[model samples]
Target: MRLRELLDATELGLLLLVGHDTDDTDDNDGIPPGTPLDRTISAVATNDLSDPGRFLTGGELVLTGLAWWQGDGDAESFVRVLHRAGVTALAAGEVEHGLVPHDLVRACRRHGLPLIAVRPETSFAAITEHVLRRLHRRDPGSLAGLAALVERHRRLLTDRAAPDSVLELLRHTLGFDVRVLSATGRQVAGARPPLRAKTAAALAARYLAARRAGESAPHHVTVGGRPYSLVPVPAPAPVRVPVPGPGPLPHPHPHPHPAELGDWLLVVEADTSLWATPDRELLDRTVELVADARAAREQANTARNDLADRSLALLHSDVPAEEIPLRLRSTAQAVVSGVGYWPRLQFVVAAGEWHAARPVPAAALRVLLEEALLQEDGPVPVSSEDIAATVDGDRAVLLVLVPGPSEAHPDPALDHAALERRLSAALARWLGPADSVSIGVSSPVPEPGNARRALEQAHNALRIAHAAPGQVTVRGPEDLTSHILSLLPLIPAEARRAFATRLLGPLRDHDARHRTDLLTTLETFLDCDASWTACAARLHLHVNSLRQRIARIEHLTQRDLSRLETRLDFLAALKSG
Candidate 1:
């Protein structure tokens, strides 16, 4: 409140000589001096004192006693000072210094100074007290009122009544509009009337500038000639919980939104000085509510994503293989809408102990994968957990289910090469130098029931990834041979091991006795399929030596090399080994 404005309401014996407005007389007009001065007084004194420039401009009750003069010679000088200083009125004290000084009265009447006489017992302190009370009528009575409002607003927001409701409450009760924006200054929610845009823009800009300078710095802005104070809310990272560290400090960047991205701001705007004690307190509470809500929302999203991922894993197993396509379709609809039909299906998986420790938080991971798939400028659907992703035709599908094809891009023209590069780079940036991720991609196969096969193929490629070094995507059916063998549905683990032992028992014993090169020779010969020259070239041996080793093996095992059964047994043993 400006001093002039405060004084205007004080109605104590205030009269104006250089009055520009018609209502210059004190509000308590027609009242005599002895009638207890009941009004607030604020009269501007035009009279010059020792320091001529210190005149009150627009206050009530400017008093003059001709006290600055001793007689006639001084009286006229005093009147000249009063006129030049722009004093509104001069009250001449009679009893203290005798009846109104003749020269002073004559000067006041000549200059039209609304002059009054003060009695001997009048105290300035009594008048000052009356004025103070009137000026403070609307302000919060005590500090507690401000503190209470701040806490109340915080609790109201925590009740989960959307942000809009909170803003409405503030506007209705506080008589000002509110706006919420992201860290990037993008408006989240708020009223933006055309009339208030300029004012709002200026205030918002100033507040943001101050916040950027130092988030903890509180700023005051005047919009539409009305003052407003803005304080920034600190957005903490999702992983940063209230653990023991150096407790919470104001963020250097005063972005009202969450610092970790994808958060919002809580901006409160009100008339200057109208942000009573109560409003300031409520603002504090609002900040806490927003931070807690953001944190809770992040957690909920993580849990939901976890459940979806687990559901997908369940769909991948337990269910009969043939039902995979149907299952994928159902899950796809549940996770992302408008997705149906899949042409080419490729499965990919990343594994290792390193992957476990710093696993992508479910929501963040989901978002990253979705962002890669969608390439959209808007919000991407990612939970705060792990990134389990799928791609269907046009829609980069996410959420867990059988690796299936989508109708949008039915031709299973899998971009195996491009996808491998993307996965490598994304994981590299995400995991940093400490971790390693091995991605195995299944060759794009025909759609429908083959979804399960594609997933199995990808899984197999991942299993044998060690064999192919420096590779992220181990694709194609060949990479998964070991897995194929396991899926034979005919040979149990123990039986397969026993069979491998029986067939290679002769060669094992022979090698053990003579330290012979029989196993190498057999593997090479079998790889060459009885071609002596090629087998010898591969073994780096003379053809004759190779023949001798082969003959010795045959003699010991009692299985002729020329026979189909003997060759089949050797081949099976080699495969198992």
Candidate 2:
């Protein structure tokens, strides 16, 4: 508050007094020798006597009766010192000095500082106290509004509310245009009209890049070929879980856009001018609210899943056949379909550390499982369980059951080799040992009752795949269920182990001693379709090293590993054990 405003409220009249030829202070307010001041002054000091350099601090409305400086030279030096020190207003007291000096008043008038005179008896302390009290009082209305925003957004974040839901809420609450963008900047949920695919694609890369960079400032990007402001919804502080192997470290970024309790971004597509000081505070609070909502919703879903998984465990134990179907359906519905009927189901199980970041939301993961069976290409009525509910421990697990393919079969010519090649081609897209996944596909089972048997079959196939020599192993039921004890069954586990032991034994010993990649070569070899060229491409290994391992395997096992029979026998033996 300005001095004038403070004095006005107190209903006190102040007299004007300026010193002559004493250019001691700037035109803003020059206090010359002998000027009377009535207001009760705080911190009275002389400028000319001091260093004239650091005498007055900027905020102190300096009260000086410039009695120390009389000459123009002294006045000029005083004015420079006061300006440098950042004094707000200078009051000249007349009773202590004399009548107002014209030169001092003119100089102060020139500089535009509020010049005020106070009678000798007026009190400045009273004025200061009054002003401070007014500022301390809080406005009830504003406080109430803040409380409401906090209460509302907490649930949204916890539920993992879609961006669209928040936009809808914004329309009714904030009364402004809101756009919810994906990490790719594509308008995932918003009031904005539909955009062209090309435009969405174009902006997606930029938005995703910015998101990955964890940009806090409102990024300026073109959306739907028009300029839009992107305010990232606040994400809840990433929940860290301790697990085996190296995990992603916390890399927090200061988010610039408004977010509430949850980690949802509150992207406002409005003019930048709306960001006033008050609004900035509101935006920050809103982010917190969003974060809260996300956390709450996630916790609720997790609790729900925990309960369902417990139920599934009970169902998995030996139970009556008649009771089995009802129990399985109940478990599926309770966990996977909290709402309407899920005609399609996919069950996915993790075999490695793939979902380190809560890769799937509980509800979404369940939905993904339900939909995995609907693919029209090869199988139908498939059930997939790759959702968040079952993605536990080191390996992520999923079971996918579709609507058809009750009796799909591999051609006699297409044996294990052809299938392995096909599976490798399909799974090559997912790279890295850290993300190794084994998929066991079961023939599609009829829905409403077949999920249990299908899940069992898929689990069996997964076990077979795990026994195979690759990071990603795939299999179906035929290999295990066939009545004929094919040549594959005749292969001895000792021979297969000996082959791997001989080929990679030296490397394993070195690895155990030095943590090396001798087994990694074998891991990559099977991943590379057992071809020298493919393995080389995958591992960047020379042909000679791969041949050496194969030769070593053959020498130690006393069998030609290059032959299809030998490879199949080895693979079966590995799985059998």
Candidate 3:
């Protein structure tokens, strides 16, 4: 209800004072007469303390007995506290005192808080009851609107309508743009125009920072000079654990802890300063509906995720080759819609730096993989029909469908470089600075029959990626040379160390004792294609000095560099080291 309506009530009419009684026009003691008074009263709370700001929320109409008021200075402090707490108006009861004090009126005027003087006969209870009644009663015209919204939400929950459709309905009903975003800044659903990925990431970062600081929700932030309010869509409450009875101990079930870092946010593209009570209530209801939709989507995806996990497991297991294609077809069909056969499938393995105390990086990586595959903003839109599954600790596997020739666009060859660039950019945008991600993409396999081999190739390629200097490495057909070297990662750590030590141990010891450069000279000579002059020039040494160093290397290692087999063995030993 409006402040003007409250003032004009029959029982409260004479009690309402808009300004100071004194003839000081500049010192209007309360809210201006012609100013808008359409603010809604959320609740009425009575306080007798000198400071009641802690108990007050914005849009509240505070009732006071003024029992703590000792002098004029107290009035100023009390009114200022209420003003800062966003109390919409003040109602002072004169039951303790004969009338409302002039000091309180002057204080309210200075703070621009509307003041309603409670009459001696009219009770505070009556005013509170009236406000509560009005809050519960909906407008007759809005009843049908509410019904339509409920029906739309029901449809959304039942899968008859999509999540974007609900966002569109809200836009039509409320005339506001809204979007649902994951904690990592990936847009889940909404009515477009869509937010840029970079902007969304920045906003998500701000929301996360505020949450970490223990700030309450409905955070207001301005992006691109436009105001927006972010309200967290809280996670569903955890299931209550049953108390154990006087029986044998039951087997403990391991349920993954709910992710504390990633939360969904409802972003409203409007200034919160203009939001009325009805607007806020509507937004709250919308958040609930969005949360329900997200839950439903996740429930549906669980089955597909299970299928992906099973398929990957089967590929790694000793499954019959003939049956592999059949099983894979079923899994592929569940994730990629309208696909009878997956002719070419590429496997991606991603691993990230993680700590035991922090949330699993693989969980976050899975979301990033999904977002990367579903991204439509890039020059080449990544298809949404991809499956990403967390396989083990700090690692996830993604199955990407390689598009083939279509009538509209005949050239179906995938741009490997562009895809890698896009994936790297997405990783940089989402992952925190303390974390790092490395990904390896395998060459496309012809069919599901080759999936087992493809998975191994991808696994080996991921090892190479970790060994390589860059954050991302793609293992295509031409990378077979490194594939042989990549097998070293699969060896046991102790065995690899022993092999390196045995081959180069003597050379290292001799060099340490004599201050010689035999090992370096040998490696440089081999790298220079056994050319004496080139190796000498590269090492900034004379030909004779290089020859002497090589002679000492040969004498120590007891190997002739002239033999091709010996050269290969030395190269292998160097690689192991």
Candidate 4:
């Protein structure tokens, strides 16, 4: 098929972003607009890899979502590789940027490669299918007829099946075992020999990584010696996970940029390439139904999130003193209604930033927080909307269950430190090049009346975290207290190192200069509570040798170790270092 013919198809909505604009003008250095792109399009391929050189050959039109794109240098390198690979033309998806990047267009033009711009309304799958059908000489009119048939089949399955059955149309009538999975690896629906949680999450990760890397779906893999195909349930327009509110939810983007962690995958226990043509089309239609299911699920989450958000707002509002308790209970009661008796809520405030110059949608912070929670707690107690999270400006606010302290569990039900670590890791998995996040947590609020104060504490902790220099920062109420060294998470690495050096600099320098073990001696000495005999026993040194090392430390640092305050200072410095 000719490039012009492909561009002319209304279904594809393809335009020449560069390479002699096709607007029938004599603007391309006196050449006609459509004259240059009259060459035949041999085939179509989608790739988002920064170096797709090994995948491409000559005379093919390559499609890209530009997810791998980071800077002008990236565009130049991609175009250079494509030029060497001898691809006929390039089509860039507007999914990420909402428009073809000028840098890419410049690079393509510089390399004398033709560039096509895909409209935001169109997906890479649509373009690939359209071009392939055109190349195969198939009738486009059959699409509507096929849709009608799929609808008839879908309705029959839905009518006969239970709600929450994913791909029941395929699982029941067709005898094709299929399952749907979320980003957290939760099996939304499936048959026997269920997908293990870890495996499902790994599969989801692979799919998401490929998509972000600009790879097309139907990602194939094998497990237990059986082949399976993972198809992304393409994100529906106006993703349902919107900003929660007392009023109607606000629809931000018309696409699914913010819903990566919420994306669902359709898994079939057979290679998609081996499927018959008719079955493939049917599977495609079934995937649409799954997307609708996902949307509905998100809609429900949005409602509960709205309720929680409203409650939080009400708790913080300057309403009549007598009404504050009632207002807080009125809204939060629904969310905590099903929790165990003596239920308590803890507040977590989070914020994120894209490492690149691009702006991350503030609302995505809510989804990121929710997904992070899912990774940590799983589905049992932390199901959808169970932990209410909402976006307030650039930050996300979440209310998480504070496992009630009981006789059986004397300690707090939650481990704040472990939660912080796990949550940081989980949040990182869902992001792209964006590597950093800051989270602040407040102590559990025993009663609804304390919700507003808890939020304030979380905000204060978040401020401290934001000022800290770290890739991932997590701070809680405990960090706001007297042991200043424990607040290291709220200190820049450079400053922390400098502080350690200032206090223990003499010992570290002396140890290094003389090649002695004074630093270790001091640490062990402090660790042993300044007991000379115990410190000597632990270090396998005689008491005299241990005393000499301590003497050297005190002499070098000009501090009296005999004083308890001096001992504490040295201990704190040693720990900081």
lDDT of 3 by residue, 1-577 (tens): 7666666668654365643343233333333344535555555566666876644545667777788887767798898888777777788988778888889888877777778889788776567656645655645454454456556565657763456666654543444567888666778788565798677867776776566445677889887887888888754332111222234322232223223233678887766545556657767777778777767755656666676687878776787776887888887777666777754657777765522223334555565565555555433345544454545555778776565535875433345565456555534433344434566666555557557655665666666665665544444423433555677789887887787788788899998999988888888976654655557878999977987887788888888775544664676678888
Query: Candidate 3 regions off by >4 Å?
Result: 1-152, 172-174, 183-186, 208-215, 234-263, 271-278, 320-340, 355-361, 377-381, 388-390, 405-433, 464-577
- In angstroms, how far off is 191's CA in candidate 3? 3.2
Ranking by lDDT: 4, 3, 1, 2
Query: Taking the candidates one at a time, how many backbone clashes does each contain?
Result: 34, 112, 1, 0
Write the residue-wise lDDT of candidate 1 on 32-119 in tens digits: 2221222233322212243333223322344443446576756566655555544444555554466666776666555544455554
Residue 34 local lDDT, model 2? 30
Each prediction's RMSD over C-alphas, in Å, is 24.0, 23.7, 18.6, 21.6
> Total clashes, candidate 4?
0
Using TM-score, rank the candidates from best to worst.
4, 3, 2, 1
Which is better, 2 or 4, measured by lDDT? 4
Q: Under the 3 Å rule for N, CA and C atoms, how many clashes does model 2 have? A: 112
Which whole-number lDDT from 0 to 100 does residue 408 have in model 3?
70
Indicate the residue-level lDDT of 238 in model 1. Answer: 37
Name the weakest run of 10 consecutive residues (lDDT summed) in model 1: 375-384
Q: Which candidate gets the maximum lDDT versus the true structure?
A: 4
Question: With candidate 4 superimposed using the best TM-score fit, by how many Å does residue 232's alpha carbon deviate from the native?
Answer: 2.5
